[model samples]
Target: MKKILNPCFLAGIIAVFSLTACRDDKMEETTPDQVQTANAKPEQPNPSEKSCSYVDSNWSWSAVLINTLPTTTDTNFMNSQMVNIAKMWGKSTPTLLFVNDPVSPGSTYNAASYKTGYRIYYGYAIYNDAKAKGGDIVNAMILAHEYGHQLQYAYNLPTVKENTGRSIDLEADGFAGYYLRRPNGYNKTDFSQIAAAYEFAQSIGDYQTTNPGHHGTPAQRRSAVRLGFLIGQYDVTAKDFDTTFFAYYNGVLDGSLKMVDNTIRPEIKAYLDQYVDELKKIQSGEISAEEFKNLK
Candidate 1:
C-alpha cells in the first residue's frame, strides 16, 4: 500500500489554477539507460505489503506518493486504482516511470513504452505539492488518468481528433472518472472527502481548451470525472463502455448535459439519479463558502 508523507507544505493557498498554455510538440529522445530501466515493469506487489518509498535528490521537480493518506484508509490507493483499471481492461500493469522535463514541468504526465511494457512520468513538482496537501483522491485519480493513456497506447482507442488531442485526453479523463467512483477505490472513505479531492484536482484544469494538447476545459474535466464516478456507482462494464461514454461525455461538453435528467441510458441513469440534485448544486454554485471549507 502507498504511504502518506509530509509534503513541501506551502501556506496561504489560493484556488489552484490549471496550467493551460500549449508548448511546442517536440519531445526529447529517450537515452539508452532510461530506455532500458523505464521499459521494465515491476511485478505487482501483494496489496498487503505495498508501500511508498521516497528518494530525495537535487532536481527541478519530483512526484512523491505516500502509501497511506491521513484522511483515508485506502493503502497504496494509487497503485490499487491503476491495477483495478488494468484488470477491468484485461491488461497487465504498466511501468511507473518518473522523469524531469524542464521543457514543460507543468505538463508532467506522459506514457511511453518498450518491448516489454509501458512507463509513466508524472510531473514531480505538481504531484509533490498535491500530495503535501492531502490530495490522495486527486493523486489516485491522476495515476489512473495517466494509465488511461497507457490504455489508449495498447488498444489504440480512436481519438477525438488525432492532431487536436481533445479526444484522447477527454477519453482519459473519462477513464479516470470511471475508476475513481468504483467500490475498489479509496474505499471506506466519505464521499465529501472524495468530492474535496476531486475539486482540488479540477482546480488545475487549463483554461485554454483550444490548445491541441489541452486536456479539457475545466468544466469538461469536471463532467468527465463525474461521468466516471457515475459509471462505477452503477457498475458499468468496459465491454459496453464506448457507446455510453460518447453520448454522455458529448452532452457534458456541449452544455446540454444535466445530471441524470438528460442521460440516455435508462438503467445506468437510474443508478445515478440520486446524485443528480447534489451534482447540480455543485455545478450551479449553490454550496456556500463556509460549507466547502468544512469538507476536509
Candidate 2:
C-alpha cells in the first residue's frame, strides 16, 4: 500500500538530512576579480572538435578531455545533461571535464564540481561500475548529483547557518532527486529506479561528524534524496523548488518543527528503516569509521 508521510514527520526527516554538509577540497573558489576580469572573447567549440571545448570564457568554464573514456560519447552525454540542467535555472552551460584520476587516489569513485567546470575524473571507471550495478540510470543519477552542486554554485543557496557543509550536500542531493523525477529531466517515473540509485548515495555516506566536510550518515543521505524526489511530484520551477526545500530544511534545523510518524511506501520505508539506528549512532558520534565502513 502507498504510504503517506505526515507533514511534520517529513519536515523532521528533511531537517536531519539538511543539517549535514560537505567540503569539496578540489573546488577552487573563484574571486570577484577573477570573474570580472575574465576575457570577453567568445571561444566557441569547433564543429570538428570531439573532445572538451569552451562553453563560456567569462566564467572561465571550459570543457576538458580525459584519456579514460572510450570516445567523446560519454562526455557528450554529460554535456547534454548539463545543458538540460542549465536551462532549468535559465543559466548558461557550465564546462565539462573528463579526467583520468582525481588528486586523491581512490576518490575517482566520485565526481566533483568546480566553478570552472564539472569534473568526472575516472569517468569510465565510475560509469562502468554504476552501469554494472544498477544500469545506465545510475550514471544519470551521479551526473545529476554533481550538477546539483553546480546549481548551488549558481544560486548561492542553502543560506547556511551552521559550521558544516551538510546543508549544501543534502540540498544538492535533493536537487538531483528533483531533476530525476521531472519529465524533462531523467524522466524516471519508476520509483524503483530511484530506490536503486539511492543505494549509491547511501554507500558514499560518511561518519565524520566533527569533520566540516561530513556529507551525512547513510540514513540521512537516503532520506534527503527521497525527500527531493517527493518534492518533485509537485509542479514547480527549479527556483521555486529551492525556495521550498530550504524553508523546510531550515525549519527543522531551528527546532521550529518536530517529527511525526506516517505510513511510508513499504519498499522505501523498509530500506530506510534498516539504517535508522545506524544513522542515530552516526549523528551522535557513536559509530566509528570502521563500523560505518562495514555497514551493509
Candidate 3:
C-alpha cells in the first residue's frame, strides 16, 4: 500500500481480498439498483444471494479475468490514479476494493462507491468490459467518476437539484470529465482522446429516465462530460466545480449556455464560448460520434 499521511484516509486497497475492516460479501448485497448515484452501491452480505464461478471462457469480459490479485505494476498504476484523483479533489484516498471472487463471483458487472465503507469497488469483469469497449483510459474515467461520488458525499454538492437519478449520476460524470484533463489526474491535454473515451459513459447510458436509477441518456452523459472537460481548464476547488457544473447544467444539456453576459468569470467564459454550439450538437446527437472525436 502506498503510504498516505491521513490515518482516517488510509484506505487499504488490499482489504477487499486480505483485510477484515470491509466485508466484500455484504458490500455486494448493497449494490445500488439500476438507479442511484455513486458508480455502483453495495448491499449487506446475504449468504443466500446468488453466486457464480469463473474460469477461462469464450465470453469476452472473462478474457482478461485471471481472478487473482493484480500484479505489482497494475496495483501501482491504480495507486497513482487514486493518488492523483484524491489530490485533484482535495480528498484522501478511499479504500480500493477488487470485487472478483476467484472461487465464487458475487458481483462481476458493477462498480460503486459507498459512504458506508469509505472506498470504491471496481469489479474485475466491468474493468475488462470497459477495456474491451473503450480502452484503458475509460477505466480511468470510471475510477475518476466513482471518486467523484466520494466528493459529493463529502461535500453535499451539486447546488442544482433535480431530485432525480440523473442529477447525481450526471454530475459524477462531469466530475470524471474534469479529472480526465486535470494535470494531477489523467492530464489528457488532447481533446480528441478525451472525446473518444466517451464510449464507456455512453455505453452505460440507459433510456429509463423516469427510473429512480436512470443515470442519463447517452447523449446527455456525453455532453455532461464534455462540459466538465472544458471546466477542467480552470483551477478550482471542489465547491467551485459544483457551482459551475450546476450553473450550466441546463445550458449544456440544451446547448443554451452562451457567453453574452455576466455572472460567469470572463476568462472561463471566453475559454468555453467556442464550444457552446458543439455542446448542443453533442447532447442532441446532432453531431455523430465520429465528428465529436474529430474535434480539435
Task: Evaluate all candidate structures by whole-model CA lDDT and list the values in order.
Answer: 0.47, 0.51, 0.63
Q: How would you order the candidates by lDDT, starting with the best?
A: 3, 2, 1
Best by lDDT: 3
lDDT of 1 at 230: 60
lDDT of 1 by residue, 84-193 (tens): 76776677876553333333233222223222236554444445555656666666766676666666666556324545455656676667767766666545233454
In candidate 3, stretches whose alpha carbon ends up further than 4 angstroms from where it belongs are 1-69, 102-106, 258-263
Tens digit per residue, CA lDDT, model 3, 1-296: 00011111111122223422323233332223132223232332333322221211111111112223355665566667878889877777787755554322323455667766577766665655556677768878888887887887788866666645677778888888898888887998777887546766876677765655667777888788888888899888877787777767776567676343465677787787777778878877889988888766
Best by TM-score: 3
Taking all chains together, the TM-score of candidate 2 against the true structure is: 0.60
TM-score of each: 0.59, 0.60, 0.77
Candidate order by decreasing TM-score: 3, 2, 1
Clashing pairs in 3: 26-45, 29-43, 30-42, 30-43, 31-42, 31-43, 35-213, 40-111, 40-112
Off by over 4 Å in 1: 1-81, 100-116, 158-163, 188-190, 257-266, 272-296
